[model samples]
Target: MLLYHTIALAAGYLLDLLIGDPRWLYHPVCLIGNLITLLEKGIRKIFPKTEKGELFGGFLEVILVCLISLGVPCAVLSTLYRYMPLAGLVLETFWCYQLLATKSLKDESMKVYDRLKNGTIEEARYAVSMIVGRDTSELTEEGVTKAAVETVAENSSDGVIAPMLYMALGGAPLMFLYKGINTMDSMLGYKNDRYLYFGRCAAKLDDLANYIPARISGWLMVAAAFLTGMDGKNAVKIYKRDRRNHASPNSAQTEAAVAGALRVQLAGNAYYFGKLYEKPTIGDKLREVEPEDIRRANRLLYGASVLSVLLCLGGRLLVQFLV
Candidate 1:
């Protein structure tokens, strides 16, 4: 049983490594993603559009899912894989970690850097738009670069690292359940009239799940920067000063750290659907962000992410010894 799990995981990772996130007909992740889209529609159907109603419903969704979808399934998987259970778990963990897109995140961010360095602000904005939720138009060179750097740092955990973290502890079903929760939070976890009530739980739950891992990823990124010969002290200094600059308690913490470490300013004014959102600055100073920053950030992300895996595996192994 464990052998199949190990082989399937390796195969899935190879598929991702070779083919990337193509919309292939047979990809398990894509198929799961599609099914999740349908599940979202069902979740949305149960709640009315009222703020009060949505809030209650959203809260219910988080509570119920935690107890059932994510919590219960993971518990079951852990029990089933019990033998030299720890070793079996190591295989699942590695597989799930591979599904995350840290490498791709770096690659995508670097594309923005490359275009911007070529003196194409317009192209850079267009490219950056894919990775971030903020409006890219009207962004200055500094703004665009900072946004890229910040997102690269933040998503290194949120988009790539967290999923793998969960999978190592759980397995496919629980991993998928986490993905569902994440996808729902991304799409519907808003606080305006439309999603205020309905999206409440998803947003909060996502925040809850991310708190520990995000900070962990931040620390790892700093170490990665140092190991790779970037400015380690600057990263630590900025992280200390700017990690809490954003409205989001967790996101700003890691992103601000990354900004400070890199010795660049991140965050400011961003346009979203024509509305200007004034955001706090994460780094101390503003410098002309170059393409190399993007490259450096990517390298840092990979180093940190891989290190995270090693640490997790080591921790699990320690647990085995204690048991």
Candidate 2:
């Protein structure tokens, strides 16, 4: 089982690195997101309007989404493996590929970088807005550059390393479960009046799920910085010093590392939902952040991703050998 899983994971990693996510293909996360939306509508009607009621409803949503995510994939994969091992491995590899977001992250961020390099500040803002949760209408070129770099840094963990970790541990089914958890958090884990009470469970669950993976990602990114010819020593320094400088326990882990490696400040105040959020900056501002930093950040992302997969494959081999 471990041997097959290891093979599938390696193949999937190569596929994602080569092609990224294709616009032509329908993604599994779309289904997960659609399910969350459908569930939220039904849950609102069935549950009361009170705070406790919404909390319960939110908890219920988490349970249902996670169960379906894990259960459906497990059933399909198990059935296929029972009747046809080759077919099972292929599907699992596809799922593993879909779950990761390495080249996609780079591609999206580079859209902003391209616009910025071309001196199209408005277009750059629009491109960055697509990837970031914050408002982008009035951002300066520097703001857009920082936003692109920050998304690339933070998602190095959320969108890449964390999902990879889950897939390595329990194959694609467990990674699906992680995606469900992550998707719920992305959709429902807001702090505004609408989602504060209702999204409490999801927010907390996401924090718990990402706690260890985020830290591991931070360390791996530090090593990646060295491997990619960035500031590895400063990456370690900022990772330890500023890794906790976020509202999220997990978000700052990789951001700090990237900021340190690139020697630019990140994670300052930003507007979300038309409201200004006062956020502390990450890393030392040794130089101005430029459009080129986006490419550098992607380099770190790729380096970290390569290191993570190597470690995961090594672990799997060690386990199989011991058994």
Candidate 3:
């Protein structure tokens, strides 16, 4: 069974590297997101508009989403594995492929890079808006570039490494659970008035889910920086010094490493939902960020992703040996 899982994981990683999430295919995350939206609305109506009520509702949402996210995949894989092991392997491989966002992350960030290289400032802003959660209306060229770079950096953990780790530990089912937690946080984990209470549970769960994987991503990024001919020593320095610079515990881990590797300032303050968020900058501002930094960030992302695969497989092998 473990051998089959190994084959599935390797095949899935290759599939993701070759072709990322296509726009035409209906993604599982879409279903997860819709479920969250529906449940949020229902919870708002059923639960009273109070702190405790919202908290309980949020907790309920967390439980329900995670269960369904994990359960459905488990059921499908179990039934298939029982009757047709090869078919089960194929489905699990595809599910693992869908869960990873390496090429897709690079593709989306490159959209901003391409626009910045050949289009108007407004066009560049619009390109970046598709990838980041921050406002884009007033971002300067450098701001836009940094935002794109930061998205690649932060998501190196969330969109790639964390999911990869989860999938390796428990295959597609557990990864779905991680994605459920992540999707909930992405949707509801805001510090705004509307979600400050209602989204607290989801946000905290995401923080916990990403905790180890985020640290592993930070170190892997540092290693990748060296391998990719970036400033690796600085990557380590900045990672250690500023890994906790963000409001979210996991977000800054890889961002600090990338910032140091690139020697550019990132994460200084940004606007979200028509409001300002005062955030401390990560890394030293040794140079101005350029459009080229986006490419460099993607290179680092790919490097870290490869390292994550090796590490996960190595761990699995060691565990099998011990068992």
Candidate 4:
């Protein structure tokens, strides 16, 4: 199992290295998007305009989406384990890693960096808008850089850390299941009039799955920041200050640490779906975010991901010894 896991991870890293994120094309994750479209259509049936119908819709949709997404895909993959063994393991790992955004996150972020460096604020904003939920139509280059950095830092927990945690605990099936839940949450887990009812379960389930892993990812990022020759003092400081303000329990830690370490303010007022949302500030009073900071954030993120894999290897060894 451990060998399979390693092989899967290595294969995924190599695949991503060889070929970057195919976001504009046929990503398997997009199938989930189609699935959401179908579910949204079905949601209207349960959410007929009645008293509390909207409320009930949110809960049921979230629950149903999570169960259907995590359960069905994992069931299919797990059944393959019976026959194919090694091949099944590799395939599963590759898919799980695809669900993860570690490399994709970094690479997409760099696109924005490239744009910012060229003084193409428009292009940078457009590139950043692809990755984050925030509005970028009017953001300055510095804001664009900050958004890229913050998203990279936060998703380091989601796209890399949390998925890896699940794999270490329960191998591929569980890891993929967690990814499904996260994917569903990202797709439909909104709090607005439309998704507030139906996406409730997915949102909550995502929160539950991320609860532990996020914090672990955060601490790991702190260590990684220091390891990458960043200031340990500020890393810890931002973690303490800004980690709590993230909408998710776990995402905050890594973002805060990176923000502090880099000495930049992040997560302020931003537009989401045409509305401005003001997030509480993280980190100390700061300078304008530069493309260089995005590089630093990626450096920290890569180190943390490597650190996680190593620690996972250690824990598995410890378990084998105990057994």
RMSD of each: 4.3, 0.7, 0.9, 2.4
Clashing pairs in 3: none
Location of the lowest summed lDDT over 10 successive residues in candidate 1: 1-10
Q: Model 1 over residues 1-323: C-alpha lDDT tens digits?
A: 43434443444444444545543434334544564455556766887667666677667666555455555545655675775665555545444544666656766888898888785899998999988898788887777877788788888887766765665454455566667667667776876777777777788778887888778888887888788887788889888777777777678766765676677777777778888888888776646676677777777777786687667555545655575
Better of 3 and 4 by TM-score: 3
Q: Which digits, one per residue and each the tens of the lDDT, describe model 3 over residues 1-323?
A: 67667777888999999999999999999999999999999989999989999899999999999999999999999899899999999999999999999999999999999999998999999999998888999999999999999999999998999998998899899999999999999999987778999999999999999999999999999999999999999999999999999888889999999999999999999998898989999999999999999999999999999999999899888877887
Model 1: residues with Cα > 4 Å off, grouped in runs: 1-20, 23-48, 60-98
Better of 2 and 3 by TM-score: 2
Q: Tell me the number of clashing residue pairs for each predicted model.
A: 8, 0, 0, 3
Model 2, 153-267: lDDT tens per residue?
9999989999999999999999999999999999999988889988999999999999999999999999999999999999999999999999999999999999999999999
- Location of the lowest summed lDDT over 10 successive residues in candidate 2: 114-123
| Structure candidate 2, residue pairs in collision | none
TM-score of 1: 0.81
lDDT of 4 by residue, 83-133 (tens): 778767767666755766777888889888888887577888899999898
lDDT of 3 at 44: 90
Ranked by TM-score from best down, the candidates are 2, 3, 4, 1
After aligning candidate 3 to the native by TM-score, how far in Å is the CA of 96 from where it should be?
Answer: 0.5
Model 4: residue 12 alpha-carbon error in angstroms? 3.2
